[model samples]
Target chain A: MSLPELLRKISPTIWELPVTYKEGMRVPARIIASESLIGGMEAGVFDQAANVACLPGIIDYAWCMPDGHWGYGFPIGGVAAFDPDSGVISPGGIGFDINCGMRLCLTNLTEDEVRPRIRELVDQLFFAIPTGVGCTGFVRCSRSTFRRVIENGSRWCLENGYALPEDLEMTEEGGRFEGADADACSDKAVERGFDQIGTLGSGNHYCEIQVARPENIFDAATARAFGITIPNQVVIMFHCGSRGFGHQVATDYLQTFLKVMTTKYGIKLYDRELACAPFRSPEGQAYFAAMKCAANMGFANRQVILHRIREVFSRLFHRSPRDLGMDMVYDVAHNTAKLEKHIVHGVERELLVHRKGATRAFGPGMTGLPDRYRDSGQPVIIGGSMETGSYLLAGEASAAPTFYTTAHGSGRTLSRHQAKKMVQGRKLLDDMERRGIHVRTDSYGGLAEEAGLAYKDIDVVTRVTEDAGLSRRVAKLVPMGNIKG
Target chain B: MPYRFQDEITTADVAFEAWGDTREELFISCATALLRTMTAAPEQVAHEQKRVIRLKHEELDLLLFSFLQELIFHKDAHRLLLHADSVRIEQRESIFKLVATVSGEPIDAARHRLLVDVKAVTLHRFQVLFRDNQWRAVVELDV
Candidate 1:
């Protein structure tokens, strides 16, 4: 049967597939998207979402966000909550890049003031932060020190003078996770990640300078609360992850789980990438600890990158970061599995929520939100393609249904090869410059692969999410300068 | 060429299918494809360094997976560009053993036209098959 035929419409923006749609499904599968977005989705997305429903101890529904697309095991925008006592943990649900996320920093300067020096700022940033494949970082440390960095996350950055106290307060989990045992990580994972603390690896990873024009503000009150008061304000945003360390940790655990999933745990999977173990088992606990180490490393990685950004901006503008009003708005991790408290069936229960390519959107008064944001909802950063504009969103109280999860980015619509074939990188660079956006990239081929046409429309994605009550639009940010790895 | 990139199989990552008359040739073709994904011009890489790898896996597909993962590890840890120069596979008592020699140099942004980094190999639809008279394998790489 066709995909649409098999799905039952739950709402205008939501679709559901009953457990009978697939064998061994523990619950229903949900897709949150508009009619057009649902029609554009590939068959693999529905299949993968259904595959996730078959996992053990899945509660309520396995959901795909508005920007959902085909992924290895779970759809990129997939979300599922599992019962901690009887549920299983799978690396595929969290992704190889443990805490791959977005960071937004606000500055007092306007686009008009920084537009003239955009080229210089971008050039310096490109040089200060390593980019492209196999690039290392400026931060050097011993193996033992690296262990502490991973275990402590951004706290190590604070002690090393790479981060400020306010930065941690604005970050998710204060830029660290407790009970992150570095000994659970493999030596290979350490060797691969130790030197990569401040580097930006390639493949859709970038640091961009954006502007929040007055005309694009959707919620002036919320925007002002989040520090976007100036007209044509310039902000710095970057998308990256834990780098090689996270990948190695995921790889090591994946192989280990595959060896024992069916042999020792008596579990069967529809896809090998979904290999898993009981959450309370020794192997599962070890992986959870190791995954947290990578998560901490990811936070430290971005913290150091923010340090570099501050230095570059201060040197170029002849003012300190504080004097320039370069304070963090928020940092949100899109890829992770965390133990969170949520009310299900009128009873509060602790659930291990896996959000791959999805962000945690906690509404006002949510327990984990920082005190400053207690009145206002958590800030959600939604990155768009370089050619298009991104969005600043706020979580809503209505997001309790999907465990406070929302879409990550404008999901890809075309393959990298297809995008490259559609446009020449040199021509794209010239075109972007004509449109008042400066870009610096290490490889033209990589740049071509990331052309704006490669992704779904950001405006449409934000509209759908807001329509579905997953998140609320705050402001739209258009790029002024970008540095791509 | 014994290998070709299959663009239609994946939307966000790279996928390739390789085949050869023998398992050794198949391994070399797969290795070459993996290198090509990292840089558009793999031929430009020089043989300035050499590393020998020995691995054993009971399954043929897993052996290939481990072999490709090793290449990615060297790139991330040492910033090296490698191509498998020689591969020999032997089966003994339910274990498939692979020994290979790879040669390349440290990555230089000025010298190499770098592309996206391949994070790890995914087992989605991953297969190693002996069809008809040839050995073939299908693999997808998460970039």
Candidate 2:
């Protein structure tokens, strides 16, 4: 049967596949998307989400967000909360790049002030921030220091003059995950990631200069609260994670889990990528600690990248980052499995919420949000393709349906190969320039692969999230300049 | 000629199918495909450095997975863009062991038109099959 035929519509935006839809399902699988979005989804997405429902101790519903697409094991935008005692922790639920996320920094400069110099800004950024495959970072540190950096995350950046105190407050988990032990990480993982702190790795990762036009501000009061008050304000937003370090961590644990998941734990999986161990087992605890280390490394990687952005802007604009009002609005990780307290069936329980390619949209008054955002809710940054615009959103109280999680980005609609066949990289560069968006990339082939047409409509994604009551749109950000790796 | 990219199999990452007359040739074909994913032109990577790798696994497919992961490790840890020069796989009882010689140089951005980084090989639909008297494997990379 077709996915649409098997799924029962719960609402205009919510669709559910009953547990009977597939064997071994622990609970129903839900997809939160508009009809149009749901209709366009590939069968692999539904199959993957259903596969997730079959995992041990998955509570409530297995969810696929508006940006859902087929991933290796769990669908991109997959979310599920697993019980600590009865559940399992799978690397596939967290992704290869631990804490791979979005960071938005607000600036006082207007498009008029930055547009004329867009080429220079992009060029300087491309130079200052090492990008592409096998790129090393600018931060020089010993292995011992690197251990501390991974353990302490953005806190190390603060002490080393790369981050301000306020930046930590604005970052998720105050820029560090507790219980991160460097000992839990493999030396191979450490070696692979230690030198990648300030570098942006290749493939769909970017740093963009975007403008918030007066017309695109959807909620002016909330936007003002998030420090996006200026009309035509140019903000710097970047997407990356812990580079090679996180990849190695996930890779190591994946193999370890695969070896023991069935023989040692008797856990059966629909896919090998979904291999997992009992959450309370020795293997699982060690992986949790190691994953936390990678998460911290991701935080530090972006922190250092933020420092470079500050340095370049200060040098070019002849003003300190602080003087230019270049304060971070927020940094959020989409790929993570974090423990949080949530009310399930009228009982408050601590559950490990795994949000892969999904954002935590904690509503107003929810715990973990900073006091400054206590009333307005957490800021949710949904990055779009370079040609299309991105959105700034706020969590809504109405997100209780999906554990306060929402879509990450305008998810891909085409494969990279398919995208490359549609547009030439040189032509894309020239076209973007002609359209007033300056771009600098490490490889044109890579650039062509990320052509905007490769992704779903960002506007539609934002509308679906809002309509589904997962998040509310605050402002739309149009790119002025971009640096792609 | 031994490998081709399977564009339709994955959306966010890259996938390919490789075949060989023997398991050794299959490993080399898979290595070549992995190298091509990271660089538009893998032949441009000079064989200035050489590394020998030996690994054993109880399963044939996992042996292939470990072999590819070793290449990714060198790329991440040492920034080397390597390709397998020769591979030999032997089975003893239920265990499969692989020994290979790989060669490449540290990636020079000026010399190589690098593509996206292949983060890790995925076990999703990962396979090593002996079909039609030829050894074949299907692999997907998390980019």
DockQ, candidate 2, comes to: 0.87
Q: Write the per-residue lDDT of candidate 2 for residues A136-223, one digit (tens) a residue.
A: 9989987889999989999999999999999999998999999999999999999998888898898999999999999999999999
Question: A1-485, model 1: which lDDT tens digit per residue?
Answer: 15657798889999998999989899999999988889888888998999999999899999999999998889899999999999999999988988999999999999989999999999999999898998889998888999999999999999999999999999999999898999999999999889999988988899999999999999999999899999999999999999999999999999999998899999987999899999888998999999999999989999999999999999999999999999999999988889999999999999999999999999999988988888789999999999998999999999999999899999999998898899899899999999999999998899999999999999999999999999999999999999998
- Model 2, span B12-53: residue lDDT tens: 989999999999999999999999999998889999999999
* Candidate 1: fraction of native contacts reproduced: 0.73
Global lDDT of each candidate: 0.93, 0.93
Residue ranges of candidate 2 with Cα displaced over 4 Å: A1-4
DockQ (CA atoms), all models: 0.84, 0.87
Q: Which stretches of candidate 1 lie over 4 Å from their true place?
A: A1-4
